[model samples]
Target: MSAPGNPGAPGLAGNSGSPSDRAAQGRAARKRVPRSAHAGWVPSLDRPDPVAVLERQGRDRLPELLPIRYGRMSASPFAFLRGAAAVMATDLAARPHTGLTVQLCGDAHLLNFGLYASPERALLFDLNDFDETFPGPFEWDVKRLAASVVVAARENGHSETKAHRAAVEATAAYRTSMRRLSRLGELAVWYERLDADTLLPLVRSTRHRRRAQSTLTRARRRTSLQALGKLTEVVDGRRRIIQDPPLLEPAGVPDMAALRKIFSDYRSTLSEERRLLLDRYRFVDAARKVVGVGSVGTRCFIVLLAGRDADDPLFLQIKEARKSVLEEHLPSGPYIHPGHRVVAGQRLLQAASDIFLGWMSGPQGRAYYWRQLRDMKGSAEVAGMSPTELTTYARLCGTALARAHARSGDRIAIAAYLGGGDTFDHAIAEFARSYAVQTTTDHTTLGAAIAAGVVTAAPEV
Candidate 1:
C-alpha cells in the first residue's frame, strides 16, 4: 500500500503549482499521450476470461450468494457491465492514461449516479455508489460512464449511430463542464451540487417533467420510517425485521452477537455529537440484506434502531468493504482498512454526504462501513429512457462527475488536457462503441457457461 505522501489518500491537497504552470503541464502531457489515442478498444488475445475474473472475485464472498450475482449479471449486457467492474478495470489498466489523479467512482456506470439526501436534508443528485472508489486517472471514470451510456442506448433499441452520439455528448459535457469549473474559485467548486428540485426546470417536455417530479417525490418518501412497515413486522409482541430467504434473513445468534459488538465499534468512529445522538436510538432488529449488482455476494446487513418510541425508526446498513478492483491494476491507495478507504473516498468525492457515515472492523477482521439504508435514495430507470432523455441524463451525469473530480483532482490540468476541442469526446465515443460490443460478447460467454453447467445461476428475481 502507498504511504503518507500518496495523492490517492484522503485529504489530498490540490496541486501546489500556479494555474498557468499546471495548464502548461497538462499541455505538455499531450505530446506523450495524445487525446485521440483513446479512440479504440481491441481486446488483447491473452485477456483473462470474464467468468474467471468473476469466479476469482466470488472466492472471498459468500458462497451461496455467488449464484445471485451471476444471475444478476447474466440478465442483460448492461447488467453484466454493472457487475463486471473487475473486468473493466483490467482493460482500462492496459490503456494509456494522462496520469492526472482523482478520487474515482471506480464503477461509474449510468445507474450509479442518483438522488440521495444530504446531511442538511436537501435532496441532491450525484454519485451514490462508492464500493470500488479509488484514486486513478480522470478519464477512467469518463470512459466507464461513456461505455455504460452506449450500452444503455443499444439496449433501448437505438441505432449504433444514436448510441455513439450519446457517448460523444456525455464526454463532451464532461469536458465542457470541467473547463467551466476550472475558472471557479476553489471554495465554489467544493460547494457545487445538483439540487434534485432544481432538475424539473431542466426537463424539456411536459411528460418528462411530470416523470421527473414523480421521481423526486418518490425519493423524498423513501425514508427509514417509510420502510418500517415494509421491512419489519410485529412478531410475538416484538418488532423485528421480516425474514425473507436469500434476500433478507435474520442473522443467526452468533452473527447477531457479532453485529451488536461491531455496532458499538462503529459508534466510536462517529463524531461526539453523532455518538450522543446514536446512543438515544436503542437497537431493535437486524437482517442480512442483498444489495446492488456487483456488490451482491458481499456481506451486508441492515440494523433497525428506535428513538423515543417504536414509531420512530432508523435503518442503518453495514456493508462489507474489500480491496478495490482498481487496486491491483493501479498503484496501491493509502488506506490500510478497506472500510476507511470507502468512507474517505465518499467524503472526498460527493458534494454532501450522509451524516451517519462511519466504519469499523467486523468479525474475522473484515472491514465494514455504516450508513443510512433508505434516506431519500433513488436512481434513474435507464432501461426505459428515450434517446433524447438519455442524452440529457448523460449530460447531467457528466456534469455531476466533473463537479466531483474538481474537488479532488487538478481540474485546470484536466480541462487543459481536454482543450477547447471535441477530440477527446469523439475518441471516447469510439471507445465506448467498441467496448459495448465487447461487453455483449462477454455477456454471451457467461450465458454459455451457465448453459453448460459450468457455473450455477439462480433464477432471475
Candidate 2:
C-alpha cells in the first residue's frame, strides 16, 4: 500500500491541482505498486484459498471481531452472508483484477444497487453504499457483485449457468459503457447517468417490469409526509417513535436540556446561511432507529423538525460514521477524513444528491453526514426480480458504475486498456462464478458454526 504524503506521483485525470490533488496522487501511487507487491490480488483461483485469504485480510483483528452478532443465519443462509462482509472483503482482495481503478462500493453485492430520489424529485438508479467507496481495482466491485448474483440465484433456485450469464451480461454492460465513455468528452461523461425510465426498456420481462413498477411506486410514496406517517406516532401527548424491537428500537426524545446545548454546536457545523435557515425550524423530536443489513448495529438517529405549523415537518437521519473498512486495506492520509470522503465521493458518483447532504464532526470527535431520512428513497427487490429483469438492473448498475469511474479518472486511457472486448467480461464471469461458489461454502461454514454454538447468530425477526 502507498504511504500518505508520497509526492511525485501521477494523479487521477482532471484533478486540476485543487484540494483533491493529494487524493489523486495517492491513487496514482497505488496504481504504480506492482500487483506482485500486494498478495491481495492473487489470480490463481485453484491454488488460492478463499478462507485463508479472508483470514489474512482480517488477521489484524479477526478474533476480536468474530463475536459480533451474526444475524438470522437459520432463517436463510443469505442473512449470514450479508453480515460477513469483512470475511468476504478479505477473500475478494485475493482475486485477479482488470487493473482499472474507480471509486468502488467495496461490497457491491446485488442488494446494494437501488433507486434514490434526487433533490429534483427525479428517481435515479445508482450504487447506494459509500462506506467502502474508494479508488480500487474495478474487478473488486464486479467480483463482489457477481458473487452476490449467484447467492441470490441459489436462493431463488436459478441454475448456475443462468446466474453466470446474468453476471456476464452485467460485466459486459460495464465494459461496453466504459468504452463508450472513453470516446466522449469529460463534461459529457460527467453528466451521464442511468435513470429509472431509461432503464425500463432494458428490463424486457413482464414479471420484472411489474416488480420494478411496484418498487418505483413505493419509492415515490416515501416523501417526507409518508415517512412521518410511518415512523412517528403520538403517545401520551408526546410524539414517540413506534418501537419495532431490535429492528427499530425507540430512542426516546432527546433531553431538551442536552439538545439545546448540542443544537448550538451542530449549528456551528453548518454554513452561516444554512444555520440561519435551520433556526426557523424548531427541533421537535428525535429517536434511535436500526437500519439496513450491514449498518444495523451502527448508531443511527432520526430527527423530526417542525417549521411553525403542525403540517410542516422535516425528517433527518444522522448515521454514526465509523472508520471505513477500506482504511484497513489501503493507506489513507490525514487529508482524507472519512466523512468528507463519503460526501465528496457521493457528489462525484451520484448525478444528483440531497441538497441537505453535508458532514460534521461531533462533540466526541465522531463524524457524520446528514441528509433527509426518506425523501422518495426506494430500492429494487432483488429476490422478486426475474432473470431478465435482473439482467437489465445489472446493466443499469454497470453503466452507472462506469460513469462514476469516469468522473475521477482518465476514461480514454482506461477505455483503451479495456479495448472494446469481452476479455474483461469473460474474466469477470469466471471470477463471479468461482466467488459465488466460495460465498455458498462460507455461508455453510457460518451455518455450521452457528449450529455448533461457536457463534451466537441472531434469531430471525
Candidate 3:
C-alpha cells in the first residue's frame, strides 16, 4: 500500500495526484496495452472446462441447491453469463490488463445495473451487486458489461448487426462518461449520481420513455412495506414469513439460533445511530431463500423484523460470503475478511448503499453480510427487449458503470487511455461479439452434462 499522501498510488483518482500526472499515466498505459489488442476471443488450449469450474464452486455450497444453480445457468446464454463470472475471471486473467484499478462490480451484467433507493430516499440507477468486487483492471468490468450486452441482444432474437452496434454504443457510453468525469473535482465526482426520474429523456423514444417510467414506478413500490403483504402472512394472529418449499422455508431450530447470534454481531459493525434505529425492530421470523442465478446454493436467509406492530415490518437478508472468484486471479486486496471485503467494496462503489448493510462471521467462522432484502430495488427485464430498447438500456448501464469506476479508479488516466476516438469501444464490441459465441458454447456444455446425468438440474420454476 502506498503512503497516505502518495500522488503516484495506483487508485488515487484525484486526491493526491496532479491532473496532468494521472492523465499522462493513463496515456502511457495504452502503449503497453494497445487499445486494438482488446478485440476478439480465442480460448486457450488449456482453458478450464466451464462446467467443472461451476462444480468446484458448488463444493462448499449446499448440495441440494446446486441443481438449482446448474438449472438456472442452463436456461439461456444470458443466464449462463450471469453464473459464469468465475470462468470469465480466468479468461480475463489470460489477457493483458492496463493496470488501471477500480472497485470492480465483478459481475457487471445488464441485470446488475438497476434502480435502488439512495440513502436520501431518492431513486438512483447504479451497480447493485458486489459479491465478486475486488480492485483490479478497469477494463475487466468494461469487457464484462460489453459482453453481457451482446449476449442479451442475441437472446432477445436480435440480429448480429444490432448486437454488435449495441455493444459498441455501450462501451462508447462508458468512455464518454469517463472523459466527462475526468474534469470534475474530487467531491463533485464522489457526489455524482443518475436520478431515475431524469433518465426518461435519455431513452430518446416515446415507447422507451414509457418503459423507463414503468420500471421506476415499480422500483418505488418495492419497499419493505409493500413486501410485507407479499412475503408474510398472519398465522395464529402472529406474522410469519410465508413458506414456499425449496425456494423459501423456515430455518431449522439450530440455524435459527445461530442467525440470532450473527445478527447481533453484525449490528455492532454499524454506526451508533443505525444500531439505535435497528433496536426499534425485533426479529420475528427467518427463512432460507434461494436467490439469483449465480448465487443459488449459497447459504442465504431472509429475516423478518417488526417495529411497533406486525404491520410495520423490515426484511433483511444474511448471505454467506466466500472469497471472491476473482481472488485467485487478482492480487490480494486490502480486506482479509471476505464479508468485510463485500461491505467495503459496496460502500466505495455504490452511489448510495443500504443503511442496514453490515457484516459478521457466521457459525463455524464463515463470513456473511447483511442488508435489506428489498429496498425499492428493481431490475430491467432483458429477455424480451427490442434492439433499440436494449441499446438504450445498455447505454444507461454503461454510464452507471463508468460513474462507479470513476469513484475508485484514476478517471483522468482511464479517460486518457480511451482517447478522443472510438478505438477502445470498437475493440471491446468486437470482443463482446466473440465472447457471446464462447458463452453459448459453454451454456451448451452445461446442458449436455445435465442430459448425460453428469450433473443434475432441477426443472425451472
Candidate 4:
C-alpha cells in the first residue's frame, strides 16, 4: 500500500499548488482524455456475456432464490441497471479515466442516496449503500449516478430531452460542489455534511418539500418496534417470525445454534463499549428476508433481539458481502474478507455510520456485515415527481456525492479537471442517454432468456 497524501503538501489541492499549475494540469488531462471520448456507450467486442456473469454471482447465493433475482432484473430497464453493476464495471473498464481515485460507491444510483439517522439521532442525507464500494476513478461514480437519473426519469414517463437535462444538471451540481469543497480547509471539508436543517432549504418547490417531509415521516415510523409487531407472532408459547413465502421465512431450529455463534462472533467485531451495550440484548429470533431488486437472492437475515423486556427491541440485518464489482477493474486492497472491506469503505466515505455496523464470517466461510435494520432510512419516490422536482432531486444527489468524494479523494485535482464550465456535464449527459439505451437492450436480452426456458424467473411480488 502507498503512503497517504498530505492535503497541505506540495502537489496537493488546498496547498502550494498554484491555481495556474492546477488548472494547467486539469487542461492537460482533457487533451489526454478529451471530453468527446465520453460521448457514447460501445460494448467492447470481447465483452463477456451479461447472463453468464449473473449466473456466476448466483452460484454463491441460494439456488431456489435465483429465479426471483432474474424476475426482479427483468422487471424494467432501471431494475436491470441496478442488478448489472458488474456489467457496467466491465464496460467502464473501456472508458477514459483521469486517474483521480476516490472510495467509490461503485453503484452510485439516485436511489442509493437517501436520508438516514446519525448516531446523534439527527437525520443526515448521504450515500446509504456500500456493497460495491472500492477505491477507483471518481468519474465512474459520476457516470453511474448520471445514467441512473436518465433511466429513472424515463421510467417515470418523462421525455428524453428532460431526462438528459436532469442528468446534465446533476453533473453540474457535482462539479460546482467539488469546486466549493476544494477552496475549504481540509478539516472543514471533512466536517461538512448534509443534515436535515441544511437540506430542507435546498428544496424550493412545495411539491418537493411535501415529498421530503413525507419521506422523513415514513422513515421515523420504520423502527424496530414496528418491525416486531408487523413481522412476528406469538405461536403456542414462543415468539417467532411469521412466514411469508419467498420473501420472508423462519431460519428453523436446526440452524439456530450455529446462527447464535455467528451473532456472538459479530459482537466481537465491535468496540468494547458497543459490545457491552449490545450484551444487554438477548437474541429472540432470526429469519431470511429477500430485499432489493439486485440483492433479492443474497443471504439476508433479520435478527430480532430484546433488551430489558419484549417491548425494548432491536433489529440487526446481516447481509452476505461478496467481492465488490469494482475489484475486477480496480486494484485490490489488503483486505481479504469482503465484509470487512465494506465496513471500512462505509466508515471512510460517510459523515456518520450506523453504530451497530460490524462484520463477521458465517457458516461455509461466507463474509457478512451487520447493521441496524432501520434507522430512519428513507428514499425519494422517483415515479411520482415532476420534471422540475426530478431535476432538484438529481442536484441534491450530486451534491451529496461530491461531498463524499471530497472527503476521500484529491478534490483540488478533480475540481480543477472539471473546471468552471459545462463541457464535462454535457459529456456525462450524452453518456447517460446512450447507456440508458444499452441497459434497455440488456434487460430485453434477459427477458428473452427467461422466455426460452434457459433461465427461470418467478413472478414479481
Candidate 5:
C-alpha cells in the first residue's frame, strides 16, 4: 500500500534522509525477502483477512501458545475475545501504513500499565507487560492499545462513539506527548516519567479522580514488608510459598543435587561483584508460580533466598526467555543473545529495573533471567476502573510508551511526521474499531474450538 499522504510512495514517519537514501533503504529491506519471510508474519491491511492470518499462525505455534490459555476458560465471550493474541496478530498483519518502528511493549493493552516500586522503594507508574515487547512498527503498539480501549469500553456498556472517542483521545495523547518529547534534549527525555503524584492531576473527571486516589492508596500499602507477609507462609517450621492452586502454587524446592551443579553456572552469569554479593544469601527453596493470562504456561520459577537469619528474606523470579512475536515479523537485526535482550530491554524501558535483574544460560541451553519476584509490585485494577478511570489509565500508558520509544530513536523526526495533526488519531481509531471486530470474531472461533474439544482447558480445581 502507498504511504498515508504520498501517492505511489510508502512513508517512513521519521525518514529525514534524501529521497534516494530513503528509497534505497526501503528497497534493500524489502528485497530478497522470503515468501515465508511473511509466512508467520501478519498480512498487510491492503490484503485484510485477519481470520485466515490468525489460523495460519495458530496452526504453526499452538504448543508454544498454550501457556496464555488459562483465563479464557471462565471468561465472558468478550473477555475471552480480548485475550487471543495469536488471532489478533493475524488481524493486525492485515492493517495499513506508516511504517515508523519502535521498541514496542508488543501487548500494550490497558491492563498492562501499572504501579511498581523501584529499587529505592519509590512507587512509579509504567508499562508492566513485556512478553510481546521488541522492535517493530510503532503502529502495531498503537493499534493494540486503541483496540483494547474499544474492548474495554464495550465491556463497560459504553456506546461505540464513546469508545471511539476514548481511543482517539489516547492516540492524541501519544502524538502530542511524543512531539513534546521530540523537542526536549536527549537527557530530558531519558529522565522523564509520569510518577504517581505527577499523574494525579491528569485525571479529569470525578470518577477518575476517585480511582486515582484509590490506586495511590493501594500502592502505598505495597511495601516490601507487605509483599513478604502476603507471598510467604510457614510450612513445617520453614518459610514457603502458600499454595493457591492454579493462580499461586507451591513449586517446591529444586533438587539439591541438580541445583548445586546448576547454580555454579548460574553464578558465572553474574558479574564477579554480584556473584560475591549473592554468596551472602543462602538458597532456601524454589517453586513454580503461574502468572498473568499471556504468561501462564512458560516455565516461571521463584527462588527463595535468605540470610543467616530467616527474617532477612528475598524472593526472585526466573522466567524462561523466548523469541519475541515482533521478531518473527520485523526485519532481522544484530543477533544479541535473548537473555541479554531481556535485561537490556528492561533497563532501557523501565526507569529502573529489579536490582537482581540478570541472565543465565543453562547447560541445557535454556536461557533464564532472574529478578525480585514482587519488589513492591502492583497494577491498576482495569476491571475495577470506571470508563473515565480507564481513559485516564490509557493516557498514562501512552505517555510512558512514548518515553520508552524516545530512548532509542530520534524524537524530532517522529514529531515532524506526526505534525501536530489528527491524522494518526483518526487512522488509529479506524484500525482499533476494525481490529476490535476481528478480536470478537476470533474469540468466537476459540470458544468453538474449546467446545469441539480441540483444545483442553487446564483442569479447574
Candidate 6:
C-alpha cells in the first residue's frame, strides 16, 4: 500500500532533482498536451474503413472462420469493440499523446484482465491476454481500459452518470497508484503482485468476498483432468478429442503429423526442467477450437496430451500470434517472430506468468505460442454488477495496470506527469463517454454493412 521500498532512497549524485522534481516535470507536461484535449473523439475524414481493416487482418486466417468472427463481433457493442482493436488503433493514432511508452495490452478491454495461475500456482490478477501487446504511449492502454468500463456499464443498462463514474474511478486509481509506486525502489515496484489472498481485503462486503471465493473455487476445478473428462472420451481403446461442429473439430489428417513435429519444436524452447516435465506426456490429439471475440478467426487449437497414465492429462493451447494492431501506427523494434513478441511482451507486463509459456513456428512458418488451456482463469460478469461493484472492479483493474506499467515504464516521470489531482481522471472520464458513442457508431456501421449484404456475418447462436 505504501510505496514498496525506502522513500528516502538517494537521488542522483550532483543533482538537485528528486521524486518531487520528477513530479513537477509531469505537472508541467499538462501545458503541452492539455488534459481536457483528450475529452474529444471524432473519426478523421480519411480514417481507414473498419470493415476493410477487419478483412485485411483476416486475409491469412482460415476462410471458414471469418463469418464466425464477424458474427461474434456483431452480437453487441462491447463484442464489436473487442474485435475492432485495429479500428481503434487508427483512431488513437490521430489523437494527442504524452509520448510515454510502456508495454501495452493493445486490446485492454474489460474482459481481458482476469485471474490466472502464476508459476507458483498462486492465483494472481493481472492482464491475461496479450495478442495485441506492444510498446506505445501508456495512455493508449488507459484510454482503451477507461472506454471499456463506460461501454460495459452502458451495455449493463447503467446510466451515463454511472458509466462516467466507473471510468473516472479507474483513471483516478491508475494515477494514484502510479504516484505511490514512483516512490518505491525499482526492484520493489517490480516485485509487487495482486495475489488472491492479498486482494480479499479490498472486497467491501461478505457477498463480494463470497463471489470471489466462488470464482476462485470454480477456477481451481478447471484442471487438465476436468477438461479431459469434458472434451475427450475413450474411442476404440484410444483417447480422442470430441468433435463439436464448427467450434471444435479435428484439424486435417495431414496437419496432425505437422502438429506433432511442431510440438517437439515447441518443447525445445522450454527450459531443460520443463522439457523433462513435458516429456512425461505424449501428444494424444489436437482440435481447432474457436476462442474469444477477437481471436475466433486466428489459428487457435486445444491440444491434448497424456502423462504416465491416461488419467494424468495436460491440455495446452497453441494460438496464432500476429503483429500487434499498434505496430503500423507506432513503430517499435522489429520482431522476427510474432510469437516471440507476444511471449516477451507478456513476460514483461505480467506480474507472474505460466511456467509452460513458450513459442514455436508451425507449418507454413506461422508463429504460435503455447500455454496451459485454463489454469485458474475467470473474469468478471460486468452485466450483472452493481454500480459500486463495477467501480471497485475498475479500481482493481486500474491499480493492476499501473503496477504493470511501473515494471517497464518510467514510473517516476509518469507519476510526476499525472501529479496528485483529479484533472487527468476527469479528462479520461469524458474521453470514455465520447469514445463510447464512437464505438456505438462503429458497431452500427458494421451492422448496416451486414444488412446491406456488403459484409458477411453468420447468425449468433
* Model 4: pairs clashing at backbone N, Cα or C within 3 Å: none
RMSD of 2: 5.6
- lDDT score of residue 53 within candidate 6: 85
Where does candidate 3 clash, by residue pair?
A: none
- The CA lDDT of each predicted structure is 0.91, 0.63, 0.90, 0.85, 0.63, 0.84
User: Against the true structure, what is every candidate's RMSD?
Assistant: 2.6, 5.6, 3.2, 3.9, 6.1, 5.6
Q: Give the better candidate number (4 or 5) by TM-score.
A: 4
Q: What's the C-alpha lDDT at position 315 in model 1?
A: 97
For model 4, residues 251-325, the per-residue Cα lDDT tens digits are 867567768989888999999999999999999999889988778778898999999998888999999999898
lDDT of 5 by residue, 1-461 (tens): 22233122121234366544534443343332211132122235465343343344444333543524533422653455444554455455443334455666777887777787776677788877665666655656777788888777777777788777788888788878988986676678878876777777887777667877887878777653565678788888988766765556655434334444566666776778878878899887766666656555666767778876887877777777666555654555343566666776777777766677787775357666777776656677766456676666677777787777777555554555555668667767766766666566656666666576666555332
* Higher-ranked by TM-score: 1 or 5: 1
State the lDDT at 366 in candidate 1: 96
Write out the backbone clash pairs for model 2: none
**Best-fitting candidate, scored by lDDT:** 1
Query: Candidate 1: which pairs clash?
Result: none
Candidate 2 vs. true structure, TM-score:
0.83
Candidate 1 regions with alpha-carbon error over 4 angstroms? 1-13
Better of 3 and 4 by TM-score: 3
What's the TM-score of every candidate structure? Answer: 0.97, 0.83, 0.97, 0.93, 0.82, 0.93
TM-score of 3: 0.97
- Residue-level lDDT of model 3, residues 1-461, one tens digit each, is 22122222243233457889888989998877889999999998989999999999899999999998898889898999999999998888877788788889899999998989988999999999999998888888999999999999989899999999999999999999999999998899999999988888888788878888898889999988998999999899888889998999999999999998778899999999999999999999999999998999999999999998877889999999988888787667888989899999999998889999999999888999999998999989888999999998999899999999999988998999999999999999999999999999999999999999999999694
Residue 290 accuracy (lDDT) in model 3: 96
